[model samples]
Target chain A: MTAPDPSPAHPVTGLDDVVHQRVRLGILTITHEARRVEFGYLRTQLQLTAGNLSQHVTVLETAGLVEVEKGYEGKRGRTWITLTAAGDQALAEEIGRLKQLIARVETTSTPEER
Target chain B: MTTDSVPAGADPRRLLSDVRALAHRVRLDQRLTWVALLVLAVATFVAIPFDYVGMDVRCVNGGSECQFSRDGVLYYWPAALLIAYTAIAFCYVRAARARGLGARVLPYALTGAALAVVFTTVWLLARVYLADPPTEPFPGWVMVLDRLVAPAGTIGVALLVLARLERNVALLVFTLGYLAVVLVPIDFGWTIHSSVRAEFIPQQVINGVVLLLGAAGFAIARRRQR
Candidate 1:
């Protein structure tokens, strides 16, 4: 009997495109923990330039995974980010998939590869 | 438009670890517990004057003997605690906003206030109802309740709720230490020998000192974390 290919059913195939990117994932994780986060704080925490962080945030915002609010704190304009219900579920699912992928790799690795 | 596939050579283990680390950092950074401790410490110290002013001589056992009671503390403690809880809630809100994070402090504030109210009511009822039988010993459970409802005890119990809300192990440890200070009897083995009695209440002073120390420790740790 021939072994069937497991690629189609692998955990990697289950990852969410919008949630799995490293920067976007970092943003989601931080926002989920904080409940709400400032754009500037997110940029500083993720070590991304303002423009770069803004672009990633835009993508997440467009994907309905995060919500953005523009307002003024004192006289300065500020933007705040918060995760919606879908965003929360997405982050949770993404983490679950990552864990499964890690477990699969651990179980399949040879002693020499380890 | 889905970018669902993992990038070539991306390590799942490393990604998961990074996410965990970031979440931990955010949790630690968002805590403003030191402010609450400091506010409570100041409130404790401020109550000393009220305790002194409230002291009165009361006759007991059919007027055979008399003793001093700090009646002012009965009225002042609950009010002080209410104000402290409000201040703590306000501070947490302001600090969280400044840091661009959401704070879950309303429950802690409300719980502390409710505990204060309940303890004060129990204490008042005990004073009114239990005072008549001066010669009779209080029941074991009443004695336990009395200790637990003391001003220091109330604060220590409230800190347990604060620790849980913050999800902070250090705060939990501090709460336990504060409770020990409240429950364990200690003697300094020295008293003022002056002809005039000192206005300071020793227990309140000691409780205030412990709170201030805890606040300082938390502040230092937070600074180091940054």
Candidate 2:
């Protein structure tokens, strides 16, 4: 199954999108927990394929939200992923921003629906 | 920190992680404080055999006192070594668990004052007032002991403060109290006095040796505390 691409009309901010966006956030969150994780493990976790995950990972790598190191184990190419320090910072700031957004929306909404 | 692939500007995370690492370092330091003390202690016991021959200075009051026959020697210099050993021990312990800054200061001053007072009191009694009693005016190589007195007291207090770990403070206190049994008086006091080094060695060396043992005992105690 193919995942839908983000809508073209709404472009994501690197800090807001790379680390704050749900999928990239999941990748960073997972990598932050691991000292170093393989690309396959990340793909399996986000229910993403090599190509789709690669696109998101490229965007994150460009933003310095994660670090990807490539090496080979025997004949197979191995790509490892880990959260960069910037990624950890971006995630924390994004998390704070998310909580604030949630709080603001909650305050404006009716209590019974929430 | 890894040399390569470390990203910049993670100050908040970096600070938090560094803080945890610092706390762990402090714990490891506290765990190892005893080792320095042990080395000093072993040096103390091992120094017992090098007692210098005493020069019996006849006092004005009617008693014979003991002192180092030679002016400068290994026994004379041991106090400085002991003091340095002690300072290192206290500093290590403090670095590990930074407690009682004021108490540490107070004892240091008191030890200095005590050394002066003890020296003067013993000197006056032996030299001017008493009849022909053998005694010396000061421990030999007084100039050599320029900074060691503080370390001696520091090691002593370090041992006392950490004595609960070994449960042998009672034995230590008892043994030092028995110094009168051998009675080899050096350059300072009346018929009854235990020279720091004793009749065989300079008193300064004895001070270092005793504190060295205390430091060793401290190591064992601190280890046990963990």
Candidate 3:
């Protein structure tokens, strides 16, 4: 009989490819907190150029993580973004994995590093 | 297509910290509350002249004596409250649109208006059934009820609802402070002994001052956050 490897799996393995990127994760988090955030607001908050934010948002939109609605507030066109249920769950899971990763790092550090 | 995996080079601790900081900034950008509080404070002050000038005296004991009361507030308060609620809603809508953020303010405004109407109806009914030209003081409980239904108390209750809608701890704290001022019996001792009349100033003035202070505090905090 052979014994399987006893080492724990890395928390990074649980991170979602669609959500792990820093900018996309920020978009998810802001939309989640604000419920429905405007595209301009997200761009400003993330400090990303319009094109950069649009690209990231497009990626998230295609992944079904966020929904974008384009409408006019008075005479100006505005776009609003909202997180989907799956997106919310993904964010929660990502945060949980990040916490596990942080804890793992702390515990594995040597006594002098502590 | 999915985005790339968490950048292998990125630090998880810094990423989490950034997410938390962004959330905190969003939470602090409560742009509409100060406007709402300021409108309510102004409404409270606007009622003073009506209260001071609109006096009603009813003769008792076959016209040998009379009782005085401020009847104008009874008429003015309800309408003023409705207008204030509407203005609050309008300010929230405009600010949300301008800032490109969505806030659940309609419910707060509607709840405030509904509460004002309910309190007004209760006060009117109480006057009709229990205390119209009463020969004696109202019971202790009735007095307490009177305080709760007053304009200042109604505003306090409404602001509590606003605090919940905005998810603002500071606003909640301010609401409690305002409610304490309204609920606790504190006399400012403003008495005018004039030939026109002698009476203690209305307590709504104190409530108004508290609301103004809350508005100023929120404004300052908001500027600092910005």
Candidate 4:
């Protein structure tokens, strides 16, 4: 089969379903930087409520961009989140594509429109 | 952050390097997992220092004549070991963090070890104060040590299993299977030496069987890829 078209950040990009989205992209970007963070920590950093955070996590999970692990530390249940390699690569490619588009828009624009 | 770090396009070498580094860090943690269990080992040894160093012990049963006593070396050995075990435990925790999931065996092993430590403290206390012996024999400490040691041995075997060395599996399987084969007669109380045959022989054989199972489990660990 033919390979997918190459992107600037990534050699070969996968489905655009999750990577093209805004909030999911934000979530994946933050996760890639932090090795592995707690669910509450992510929610706090994202400034999203319990419901919003949970929904975003589900979307990312479905796209295989993230892994959500929940286990008990003691009496209380704890959840940890981490970005999958696929998610990381996808994010990089998306960021590259976005920047390239912005550069094109700026360079082609009239000086007055700047 | 950018593809410029390596190349503009995908580089299998770059990806492999990153993945390999992360994998190595995780393994380092697993390798050192058992150091945590060493605490129990040290506890057992701690009892050695105080074995019979100062106190005078005696087996003064309700109406019995006499039996045992205590000494210095007995106490010193266990005490020294306890210190050593603590050092070993620190290393183990560090290693566990390195190995990632491989270190999962640590918690249970350390907990069992901690339990053994508790029993050891009780046994040593009893030896120093209550019923005593001439040589200050540790009463229930050995069993605690055994409980911890057995799991440690299992974890070691698990690591071997994790490695998935084909030869090692065959060797381990052979060794365990051989032991099970040899233990057959003894477990059934048919040892050439009458004294060798005991009620606990079955348990020993059972442990051998379990070892074989552990080896089998390791062989299958790779079936589920990361």
Candidate 5:
């Protein structure tokens, strides 16, 4: 008998490593639907410290996936983040890969087993 | 357990489920276009019942001195659409929050307020023109234009919001399609003694068309999303 493939039954070769990070994935998904997201709001939602969120945001910014704007909202300084076109495309691709994963698993397993 | 690494015990199904859940949240929020169309449907239905434009019959200068009896704009449709849009805008703000997006409500509120102001201004101008004896005799087109202005202005606000905020092509198309319905004749030139049944029926038909269109847009969007 032929040996079975040791690799995962559902391979997601197109998965974006930049977006696959849990927190960064969260950030991209949130900003994809919003016009712009405040830095503070992203931190709160992701439950990350300011330093941690800023680091991830910097990585995204460097990749040209997100834009960061610093300005004053009234008297207080505020930072806003939004996905660039590339970021939007990346998120779409990530979700497409995820959907493929789900579809593959669904088809491979019986309903009762699933 | 670290930020970069998946848990050692994590099954692929479990990991995939978590990712799926997050994507589902974003997808649900992205469906705000359908919510906007639903708002239009509700607004049209609510506005349909109040289609008749009631005129202020009170004389202004002296007894029987008023040039027109039904001059002031009732603005039933505009009010309905405005209310629905405002409500939907709030829903959008909340949905964004739920999906980990930060959005301010002030802009949405301002959009609705501006629309109300525009509709009100058009109605007031039509009323003033009707009240004046000098301008009322000619330019029947002015009355028709004024009547068209309310819904046009309402849809204009909708279009602006859709363009800047929603950015949904199908919703934009439906809003534009609604303009054809608004173009149906409104008899603002009718005298105080004229019957409103003629005015009422066409408006009801227009409202029906709007409701159907809005409902269809919502359904198609929902289906495509599925």
Candidate 6:
């Protein structure tokens, strides 16, 4: 429940844990480029069950990182998901932090590690 | 601050690699679209100059006359291809944005406008304005090749890109439409020279098959996902 540190040197600690989770991170990365993703498409890509994906999506929705839409395509019910502005920003910051973490590792590693 | 908070067994290198892969996947379509554009651009550059070089006059009834005809055949084919390539790139980028399936009309309109401009400029330079008239009748087969090369590369690259993106119908429509546009007209109206047809037809056929196969793969992948 701490605010993300604004300084570049402390990037990793500020990483949004919500976006740090692998499946949700994947969803955000995919949806950031797509106009919106169908629920089925997301489920298939992430290899998550209907219930599992719904749970992750609920977490994202609760955090205001994603918006879910329900409608019907032809005779079948359909769900579509898209990242919200906050979600997009969170994903960007998370990626930036990951890059910074990698840079830190590179700088601090021993010669044998290199 | 210490790296202790990274938790046990957390590998920074692996995390970076994973995120990089994710980003690469997300941007695949855009990268493919640019490749398609670049391929067409290079093909046009190489093909047009070869077709236009050493042509000095229009042949009227087997007599070389200093007539006011530009290399109309040469100019028109590349012009058409340029319009087509640009249209496809613009459409692909927009469709990747997912407004709808083959939905936007602006690219098509822009293509028409581009062709008109090319036609007008080439015409003005070669005929009306009398800047520099072409020396001879441009070869029909070269024009045919020009028509084929650009779309072949543009759509060919697009097929590869869309296959990765898992956009089944878009890939199918684009492949089929490419075949129809590039192959059908040449077969019916322009295949007058056997030598020209022999050289280019087989290549076009190969391109068509590759595009269709790629589209089919995407379709299969999409079906499995559904």
Clashes in each model (backbone N, CA, C under 3 Å)?
A: 2, 29, 0, 30, 1, 3
Ranking by lDDT: 1, 3, 5, 6, 2, 4
lDDT of 3 by residue, B126-201 (tens): 6678654678877877776677888778888888888887778889998887887777645456545442222524
Residues B46-153 of candidate 5: C-alpha lDDT, one tens digit per residue: 554444445444455654454333332355655665677678778877776544465544465577667767777766775676555564355767655654566544
Task: Go through the candidates in order and give each one's C-alpha lDDT.
Answer: 0.82, 0.48, 0.80, 0.47, 0.62, 0.56
Which 10 consecutive residues of model 3 chain B have the lowest summed lDDT?
Answer: B191-200
Put down candidate 5 lDDT per residue, A16-63, tens digits, no spaces.
677766778778877765557778777765678888889889999999
Q: Give the per-residue lDDT digits (tens) of candidate 1, residues B119-207.
A: 88887887788666568767767665676787778888888988887788999999897887667633254344231124336767888
Q: Give the poorly placed runs of model 5, Cα more than 4 Å off.
A: A1-33, A36-114, B1-28, B51-82, B102-109, B133-144, B184-194
Off by over 4 Å in 3: A1-13, A73-76, A100-114, B1-10, B53-55, B59-71, B131-142, B191-200
lDDT (10s digit) by residue, model 4, range A1-114: 999987455323432655554446556755664445567655654466777778878988998889998988668677777888888887777666655554655566888877
Off by over 4 Å in 1: A1-9, A110-114, B1-9, B60-64, B67-70, B139-141, B186-200
| Candidates 3 and 6, the one with greater TM-score | 3
TM-score of 3: 0.81
Q: Which parts of model 4 are misplaced by more than 4 Å?
A: A1-17, A112-114, B1-226
Poorly placed runs, candidate 6 (over 4 Å): A1-8, A111-114, B1-10, B23-62, B66-126, B131-226
On TM-score, the candidate that comes out on top is 1
lDDT of 6 by residue, B130-170 (tens): 45545675687755444434444344434434444543355
The CAPRI-style docking tier of model 6 reads incorrect
List the lowest-lDDT window of 10 residues for candidate 4 chain B. Answer: B1-10
Residue pairs whose backbone atoms clash in candidate 5: B55-B70
* Residue-wise C-alpha lDDT for candidate 4, range B93-205, written one tens digit per residue: 45433322312343444444454355456556756676533375555655444333332233333333323422234445544543343333224443332222232234433
Better candidate by lDDT, 4 or 6: 6
Q: Model 2: runs farther than 4 Å from truth?
A: A1-15, A111-114, B1-226
Which candidate wins on lDDT?
Answer: 1
Tens-place lDDT digits, model 2, residues A25-92: 65666565443557876676556778878888898999988888898866978788777888888877
